[model samples]
Target chain A: MANDNGDDARILRLSEQDNVVVLIQSVPAGERLRLDGQELVMAAGLDLGHKLALRAVPAGETIVKYGAPIGSATADISFGAHVHTHNMKSEYIANYSEDDPYEAEDGS
Target chain B: MINSYLRQDGRKGIRNVVVVAYLVECGHHVARKIAQPFEDREEHDVHVIGFPGCFPNAYADRMMRALTTHPNVGAALLVSLGCESFDGQGLKAHVQASGRPGELMIIQRDGGTRSTVEAGRAWVEEALTTLQGTPRVDMKPNELVVGTICGGSDATSGLTANPAMGRAFDMLVDLGAACIFEETGELIGCEQYMADRAVTPELGQAIVDSVAKAHRHYHTLGHASISVGNAFGGLTTIEEKSMGAYAKSGSAPISGLLKPGDIPPKGGLYLLDMVPDGDVRFGFPSINDTEEIGELIACGAHVVMFSTGRGSVVGSAISPVIKVCANPETFELLWDDMDIDAGRILQGEASLEEVGKEIRNNVLAVAQGTLTNSEDLGHQEFCMKYKRFEPIGPECLPA
Candidate 1:
């Protein structure tokens, strides 16, 4: 079983070159945890398998994971904040979500 | 280490299956009814595979011919609705020429659905009886052809199941078995990494170009091949999902690039280009997981490995499918459907190498006739679609 408490939740830093870490369990927003001798609080509630910023990243900077550039940050992200679609975009292609109004066109 | 049967073409198979294939969508119901009785039979392996396209196509024709004559097949019963355009007789002749028993029943000429189903069922019954005489042969590990794919993937897929496949693939290659990794659309972010692993510089360039083509296809279609389930499972973008998907290929040097239905001449490791050639005008941008599995079987994969995080429980018609679960939580929910719990790595109970060895042992056991979960559950899922591709160039191969 996984621990859900902020300080006890496990996270994996995949590579030495990566700037994001993946949470092994869900952690709530406002829960404080320590990493690299710095105390940081979760910026938002996140579930298992979600990534979080390991350090501050500015807008348009590359977000590295698995030692590769997965995407670029869309805004400045502080340490321990959830890093996902709102803050990042892929370099190769655009994402198509079913909920996006721009993509859902009526077929005749 | 396998107790297999040798085909006239010299390929070996672990199962002597009787395939009842429908030439068009209209023939599907009758074909299914014909194949239904033997689905759960202990010794009889009768399954349905078909091309649903009514229009005649070279791609579909080739797929059907290759599949009907596949080594795992002992006999085939081709079903036709009597007017759609797939060369039913030509395919039957092709199968017979390849030294396999082939029979056709056209609904229009054979007294419609009721009579055709009755006749087809009778033919399948006799074929199964004849297949009982298929000679068993000793097959070595070097003769195995294995393929890998990841579907219904989530974050743990890359972390656990996919990388475990990578290690298993590496071990298979070292043991002189041919291994294939496909779905170039899922390899979007790691093109350069794949290119760098190619045995020859020319093959590397071809690898990169293929990924670029996939990039354009999805760009033109406005669909990134990422599913709603993937996003909900916490895959943030196509690139992120792709990075996870790429790990299934392991770290072996890529020996060649192949199109659908093209068997690898001699495979150390081969990258199968799943997207069709040319722009969006001629064909579809990408296909689903089950369709990709059909292509792998067409490429001569004796068995296939499928890794999943959100969970997929499909098995192919010709070969057994080994399902590796990525999420320990998902495993708890779908334990009866999975073969191996690769999620143990994510749960800190097992190392990747340990699971990789487990996968390798499972493959050998499966080759030696151990039933996978899907096989025991009778999940013989199969699908194929129409698509065009120019043959791969010589430069795309290692030799």
Candidate 2:
């Protein structure tokens, strides 16, 4: 279980191998966070439940979470950057789009 | 000790319900009207479940048969539209063979909706009276089969509700109960890890092959199972969603693999392979949550534990559903529909073990005759559609 701090902790790291930590609460841009005894400032406003990079990840590298690969980075990402669709893509399937060829008539 | 209705097949039921099923969409309205009177009556537990497809599908027939003879159902009233392709007679025969009262009402021959509804109601009333004298038997935890499915999932799901469900499943399996977790499409990336937990190497390979089949089928369809709501909830990729969804299985060893309607032969943890075999004839494995719930009940699940981050309120037609809310915000908005506040783990108020214990207790309470949140609100959502699958090999269910 993740630590239960009253208001001091704002992020949760699921595993030691994970390169990202999930935010428990939203943080405003420019807010300084002292996570794992390391000080870092938010480059942008982070939404609640979103991921923040725990370390620098280069382009084409797999993003690890829960001790497994979730996806690969599309571009070089710095430490503390938000790790989402803009920087990563699925390793198993191609990126999704509305006009893809496999679109069914029922649109399931 | 828990008291349950004893079926002639030697299975025990948590609820003695009279199910009114429609063979096609044409008979759905008549079946609903027949069940309307018993909906408000506490003594009579009548539910409406059906397949709406006009085309004949063997999988649909099998599921209907499984549901009609389900331990929870004491009697069945099947409604048929004379022109539809569904096998109403076969379903009726199968139900009767299970030693339960079965009746079929044809709307076209019974003089349209009004006359058919009147006749169907009378038959159901008689069935309910016969069901009232069912013998009660002591139920052991080993005789119970439980299933878990996650819906409307968000990031908090992996952190709280899903893992807590995993803990509860582990506890159930430890108590010599049969537990099942399903939806292969949602389990994309974790195939290798799942296979590693199998009791036998052959079963492990079968688990791997099932996920591979799902990958190809979904790839050809040009869409992953990850929905737009999932993306908005901060899930970035299919693998992320898969990992979260896989947590509901907990740390139990995989005892066997089962296709839809295949009852587990023993007390242990099993995986329901929802992905169809052969070509992709069916557009999707499941159209929605209710379809999967229907399949779980077909496999003899007495209770379903549904974990949701976006707050789903659907209860199954035959089996009872216990809702576990993952998101603290969603829990605040839909407290009336939620049974356990697993979001308390996210809010730092409770541990995952505590929530898991709550879920275990709730499962036993529901089996002992407590109406779930959705049941109290009269939410008996059900759906069935056409699909095909090859039979499982001996390796998939090794002795």
Candidate 3:
């Protein structure tokens, strides 16, 4: 369930294990925050559906969602950093692995 | 109570419909004027279905004949411009032979649009009267042939509703019923895995060949992205997207492969190859959901099981579309639009098998003439753009 603040701001939860939170409504940088009984400071501007990391994460680590690894971090991400294309890549895919199945001549 | 009207072909239908069919694009406007006003009201007697082509097409002929003879259609009103190459008389004869009343109205000869609309209304009213007297019988679950398709797919689709529907498809197939899964374009990466599940070696190779054809076809059209939502859901490549979309078929053996308008011969599990066979005459494979449903129904699917992660609110012209919502949050947001909630599996409130049984039961209920959300809301979306497909080779279906 999402609640609208006095000025019409909303929050969305992507997954249970996600340490981040998504704003359904845009919020200014340095906005006060209260989530899951934690008092966290906003590190940057937040847009609708963008994630804010609740805790620090390392590079090359997998991002869990629905109790499964949806993708892995492309770079070392600090707490409350937005998790998106700039830092994450799908785990079910191979970027440059030699085992790339599509590259096979006969696709054995 | 489960009630059905049995057709002359020995198939049972949940609803008795009176189809006002237009034979050519020229007759569409007058036919629509006659059938348009009857649009959302469920008198269980009035509905319009047609194919728009001025030229003769064998595929269109077969489809019109099959649909007019469909158990759900008790009678049909054929509107023709009188000059088009479509065999209006032959189609009427087929409908009549199926023990259903068929009437043909030539718009050019009937004193133009006004007179034809009046005549068409009278014909439909008479057809409805005849359909009211048709006998209703009990329908069996095992006698059903259901098809499943997923659109607006995202990451959650593979993990949830698709697998749930797969479980239901497996159950139906085991109960001596036939199940069809389609959209070969969305099935690129998992072709080998699916081929390996074929009941026969030839069927396995055929599966591989069909997927390859689909890959080439989509590539030709520059539609390798599969779904618009694939990009939104963070998918970058065709294989990653295909791997997620293929979860809807479950572990069922690949029983056969069929072209767009081809129906399965005997039925265990069949794959409907939706790609064009030749030099891409049709613009896109399917512009939207209704065209796919129309093709599925043409292939003798009694019901269509549609899965969506982003929530789609659509129904077919002839058959019912049972929507299974995949994303848990999307399900919550669009709860009223869904028929089954496969997202409950994510919440630990329901198991995959439990949701599967619910989906199967819903299919049974809808087959018995129960209306789905889209149908209830009057979503009779239909579109049949041009496409060329060579008939399936014998190797695609093995006896």
User: Highest TM-score: which candidate?
Assistant: 2
lDDT score at residue B190, model 3, on the 0-100 scale: 61
Candidate 2 chain A minimal-lDDT segment of 10 residues: A99-108
Model 1 ranges with Cα > 4 A deviation = A1-9, A13-21, A27-46, A50-64, A67-108, B225-238, B281-283
**Highest DockQ among the candidates is held by which one?**
2
lDDT of each: 0.83, 0.86, 0.73
lDDT of 2 by residue, B82-145 (tens): 8999889999999998999999889888899999999999999998889889999999988899
lDDT of 3: 0.73
| Native contacts present in each candidate (fraction) | 0.27, 0.31, 0.00
Candidate 1 at B268: error in angstroms? 1.7
Better of 1 and 2 by TM-score: 2
**CAPRI quality band, candidate 2:** acceptable
What does candidate 1's lDDT look like per residue over A1-108, in tens digits? 322223233665555688987776677888776654567777777777788888899999998876677889999998878888888987864222223232222211
Which ten-residue region of model 2 chain B has the weakest summed lDDT? B225-234
User: Higher TM-score: candidate 2 or 3?
Assistant: 2
* Models sorted by TM-score, best on top: 2, 1, 3
